[model samples]
Target chain A: MRTIFYISDGTALTAEAFGRAMLSMFPLKVVHKTLAFIDTEAKATAAVNKINQAYADSGERPVIFHTFVSIDIKRIIMSSQGSCYDFLDYFVTPLSKELGIPAQPKTHRTHGIQEDTGVRENYDFRIDAVNYSLANDDGSNVANYDEADIILLGVSRTGKTPTSLYLALHYGIKAANYPLTEDDNMENLQLPKVLKPHRHKIFGLTLDPQRLHEIRSKRREGSTYASLPQCRFELQEVEKMYRREAIPFLDSTRFSVEEIAAKILAETNIERHRF
Target chain B: MRTIFYISDGTALTAEAFGRAMLSMFPLKVVHKTLAFIDTEAKATAAVNKINQAYADSGERPVIFHTFVSIDIKRIIMSSQGSCYDFLDYFVTPLSKELGIPAQPKTHRTHGIQEDTGVRENYDFRIDAVNYSLANDDGSNVANYDEADIILLGVSRTGKTPTSLYLALHYGIKAANYPLTEDDNMENLQLPKVLKPHRHKIFGLTLDPQRLHEIRSKRREGSTYASLPQCRFELQEVEKMYRREAIPFLDSTRFSVEEIAAKILAETNIERHRF
Candidate 1:
């Protein structure tokens, strides 16, 4: 197994998020072992020394990859002479292209502070502690279908709502979801007719009957919908539909909303550029 | 505007998260941004030169700050001696320490690609997924408490539910909230008396009366709670109570759940270390 470090200078949430996403691709393989941080300048050398040691201590030849913080530093590291210097030559070139970020060609005056603050609390986006009103504040679903990066379809409480919201907040992915209501389900082929044409983009969700029953119980207890027997039958039917239709489906019973969302993203091969 | 490349080699989410947090901190300034990534040798070099141009072209001196994925790259750049090599030195020394990580370091081989995988399809953690054996799985307040990292206290629909779930999925902060019914309101504090001691950790939610009215009106057209006048009066009373008890609050009329949450985290000085 190769050890990979997802380094970030900001809050590291971005690093963790993308890290988590990559791991999800190989769910049973990548484990984010530990998170190490450096928030200031004095610690830069120490952080460097440790990475260098990573190579020396390992008896095996491991890929020692590294990315730096600024234009000046990149140039400096690119020019530095040392045993680890060769490692930099080995990793920095190709890594930049896949990410779409351009390299710093020259070093001008840099606002160089050496410590790792991880993030700067600048409060740069809010004005008067209120967001500027959206062009359409009426919640009329003015968002166009064409503009949606991905669309989710599931029955109510299948964890779609939270999943859509997570993508929006984390990846800025504009996601839209449609619920398969009782009427729609009653009128269904294994797949929703409207989704037939968008088959590749469409994904399905299913839940263990008992789990669905428990979740629905919290929303509307004592209702027929929340009854265990009813849920059991509904789940069986949904699973059958998914199999018959050959739609990619996930059991939402065990996954956290994010996990379920990630699974769908993975299974459906939803190519989200920004999100 | 100065450019800021929130670069990441492995996970872009962490960089974006820190970017958002930094943006929130500095609402007025526009920092040129890029959450682009670098994972291979070529892409890494291109990204280095891109930052070079941003700083080189921007007439003024700009900070070339980098974080997580960039840590190692920072060293690479620092090692590359040049006109900017002196500046690179400042960042390298301190970074070395954090890279060393774990004062008492623990090393182990990776077991999976991700440390956690949402809950997993087997509902492995869903006690019910196994047998009814969990029925006797420890008669403790454990599940109830284990279900939330923070339990919000407020009246019905004061934005507790969304925020609670958001914290859970986003920060993995287990959050559950209990509403302050009329009974609790009369007691003058939103928090349940039993939970008062944990008050510092509890966040009190309140909304402008008119806004509250508009929200309630959607669900209960003619109910007293939906009346404009009643909403105004309730809001006044709630604000007064908050002041009397010195409970911090935010007006939810214009805030998205994410914004409300971000504000609360900031005001409460709760640093979600993930990002």
Candidate 2:
């Protein structure tokens, strides 16, 4: 298999994003390597050697997606035996002309901490949101629902926890998730009383019964909790409650956590703390 | 302030990443707005209206970084009164030529579920890792240390939890973190007995004493636990223990969680389950 390299003088996160987005356009299987924080000339030379080695070993030119602030290091990387793509360098000129300002390329500017600024403030908000989500996970702290930006309601194993964490980590939104379990009376499910006052903040997640069955079976096989009938019945009740309570929800069977979080943000009016 | 828009037919995550990386090159303040899941022509027209409205309201052309698989939608977005940048379109021809494959542009491919493939497996790994990290957090499940790809050790408020979660969420690496607290004999700290066998998987995180003090102060006001002297002493003991035990450590004072996670991945040999 061919190798794809994401190299940068900083975290190389932008390079990874660039490569991943580009590669998503082609249905191809390839090995991935990231050379991050390649700041010095020596390190850049070493990176070039690795790229050349990959090329020799695979008998194909490796695809390199790189972003570097230092011209000298970037020049060294461009000289490597690979098909290099620098999205930053390609767009910087046009963007500079459009903004009518010279681009001030700096290392770590993309994913670095800038103290006493919005970046630092955003960092604190994300960490706090993570802690809040953990503290309120699975209805552990219902009293704090008033403080939540959004509360996720769903049956167990319908992907509440991961979605909650993704919202908190990526957007710095305080998301608390509560699972609808057997104690909620699956025969006649209702929004828990503690959640009634904060109904406006509720967003629900539901999975297809078959998908739920497979997921639950992995955890508790040969049990009624993992039974298809149980999964279908619980989903029917919870979705009915969603409509009855007028809670906006998504079918998470076809979406990743990133997509689910993005959809929730787009569907709701929750203000994201970070861009 | 000028408004920067990240518009996409899918999650808009790639557009946001592209725009943010480009914008980070300039020292300017701008408002960010994302219009995600604009798949239909009507939604495309609505997004154009939003973009045009931002241009008119600000008296400055909105900078739109967008990626759309549909040609009609792309054209509609381009027709809006904004400066548009489509990184995917710009890089596609070259990348396709390099790979010798026709670009199969698909919506939601970048951050969507691909059933029964590496993508789906990756998603499962991430969710499982998140559950594992939460379960093993703060040394809560010491018995599960053998399953951890990496274990982060740090004092209180040194950015262990966020880093652990980021490692799990972004890389699908099972990360468990243990907090080295006053219970560990702060005056003469040593690697806890539980962590001795898993020493090879250990990574230490330390922060500048002042930063730690400020972080703790936010949570506990002026308590002794939040004092500068106390913070300094704990960090000192932890760092001493890390070096004494021959564990790799990082001072996470100047980095964001993303950067810290990237640095840890670079410094360690932990195999990531996802690219």
Considering only chain B, report the TM-score of each candidate against the true chain B.
0.49, 0.98
State how far residue A8 of model 1 sits from its true place (Å).
20
- Provide per-model DockQ scores: 0.06, 0.76
* lDDT digits (tens) for residues A7-84 of candidate 2: 998899889988989998888889999999999999999999999999999998999999998999999999999999
Question: For model 2, what fraction of the real interface contacts is kept?
Answer: 0.77
lDDT of 2 at B37: 91
lDDT of 1 by residue, A1-275 (tens): 33434332222333343333323323232213222223344434544454445545553222222333443433432232212212222323443342244433221101111123311111111110111111111111424444455556666667665556555544445556656667665435366655555555556677877778877897799999899887777777766777887767777665455455555554454444332
Give the clashing pairs for model 2: none
Cα lDDT for residue A119, model 2?
90
lDDT of 2 at A95: 94
Q: How does chain A of candidate 1 score by TM-score against the true chain A?
A: 0.50
- Model 2 spans with C-alpha error above 4 angstroms: none
Best by TM-score: 2
